[model samples]
Target: MPILMLIEYFRATMQQWSFQKRNVAAEAKRTLTPWAETIIQANKNACNNWMVYPISNSRFVVKSFTHKSVVVDFQQRTCTCSRWQIDGLPCGHVIKVLTMSRYKDCSEFDFKAYFIETLRKNYEESVNPLPSPLESKIPGDLMIVKPPMMEMRQPGRPRNIDRILSQGERPIWQECSTCGKFRQTRSDCTSRGSRSGISQATVHIQR
Candidate 1:
């Protein structure tokens, strides 16, 4: 029942998300919102304090007044500062270069992942509702599982322990009295017909 509830909850969430995406996509005229444009413009205006050196028609080097420099590549849509490739948005360095190259719209330099068409296509598919699994006809070849098996082990601390030791601590090795071997307890000793230790223990108990 919990599994069914989980599947139903996810289905409902997907439906809701699809609806929201469709609405936002329909209202979107451009990739960047007005707020994003405002931020980009603010950065573009601040670029006046930076120096731009054009390396080629597609690449340029930008340096801030603070002596920090970064490379901007238009063909690759990447900046050395990495904001252009990471966030799919142009960094201030790229904006500075675009202005020098006489590009009027800075938003056009954004990656296709941030495009309005991509946003519209992402939510085009509708999420369908699921029927009850118990009511549905299941295939005969489907593998079924059972939980009738019993746990045969005791519920308590075990004697044979295998774990890491603490710092500067030596390992504790066990020696069996019957087998006279390391790491084997007397109960699991494999020395055949070794009853001398048991006879002496019985005699001590009787005395």
Candidate 2:
């Protein structure tokens, strides 16, 4: 019953957007986070600033204005910084090497996993509407089961009475019981005297 309601809700929502352009890739590209776009743009700009020196057919060394260098291998799709290998996106150094190699579509160095087409295909499947419960034939012997009992939680901060911490799981710092300052116990606390004493000292200093 809940699944049927969810399907119906999804169908109704999809109907509202059915008239809009249905390009999944375009939609996915539009939804890229600002930080992601910034990184891509920064990489592009960095590619322009870096100088590419060819080492072999597929290998090169990219050097920045500051003499900071990184080795780039187009064949392995890797950079010395490891960013390209880990993220599957070409780093600025790799981009500069690709540009020097005369590759027109340096952006293609980015993994297809980040492509809009891949994203679109993931969400392309449509949920079908389920038949009305009244029209469906259920067995006469099968009884309608009641929902499981759920205790209403009391409105307050829950206690961790059931929590069992291991011997290894100790707090990062010991705190004083008297002053509540961390990294020391109550015995080590210097401010154990009355607050009035500290207040009087402050007033005296001010005067």
Candidate 3:
């Protein structure tokens, strides 16, 4: 079967497994006892490093120990540091604002795009297993693709793909063959008085 067709065939299977992994993780993060302890520690650390001044139920200003100020808005789900909008997780400043809010109706999401119920509902559609590749058959009208032609084998030991060159190093000829010096090739070698190598290859080398 074609590579693309293979991917499409297992697309549902892939999504099903991926959802399972994320679901497990989200549940773990939400319920982890150690994480709660960590949060309590983080809150204490936050107090030492930052000062939050409430502007409204949903807005606040957080000032760091270094005097760097960032705005936090719970209503818009945004922070000046951009973690809330970009990472889809509340930033430290926004978390502080939430802790101070007194309104019972000033609600916030469990998380920005990854609530437990949302993940379950999104992957709720019934997914059936695809037939084994050996058991599957291609349509007769579908054009059968031939194997790709083998590349011509290069002579000499293959260059190690993992080899990293140092600064100013490359695979190409770095020294002039005639004079065995750097920064100049045989085509423009001015120190040819010392040696007469690369005479044959000079014709092939560009001027």
Q: What is the lDDT of residue 72 in candidate 1?
A: 90
- Candidate 2 per-residue lDDT, tens place, 1-207, comes to 698888788877875454232453445554333344567678878668778788898888888987578888878778889998887777788767767767766557777666556565555655445678899998889988899999999999965533555666643465568777765555545686533222211111110
lDDT of 3 at 19: 72
For every candidate structure, what is the RMSD over all alpha carbons to the true structure, in angstroms? 7.0, 15.8, 11.0
Give candidate 1's root-mean-square deviation (CA, Å): 7.0
Better of 1 and 2 by TM-score: 1
- Candidate 3 segments whose C-alpha is farther than 4 A from its true place: 1-49, 56-58, 103-112, 133-135, 148-154, 157-207
Ranking by lDDT: 1, 2, 3
lDDT of 3 at 145: 84
Residue-level lDDT of model 3, residues 1-207, one tens digit each, is 498587875787787787775566556544323333364446445645577787876778998876479998768878898866665545567666665553222214335344544554555664556667778897889988899999999999865634556676655535777778765667767665544654322212222
lDDT agreement of model 1 with the native: 0.75
Candidate 1 lDDT for residue 39: 65
After best superposition, candidate 1 residue 205: deviation in angstroms?
23
Assess candidate 1 and give its TM-score to the true structure: 0.66
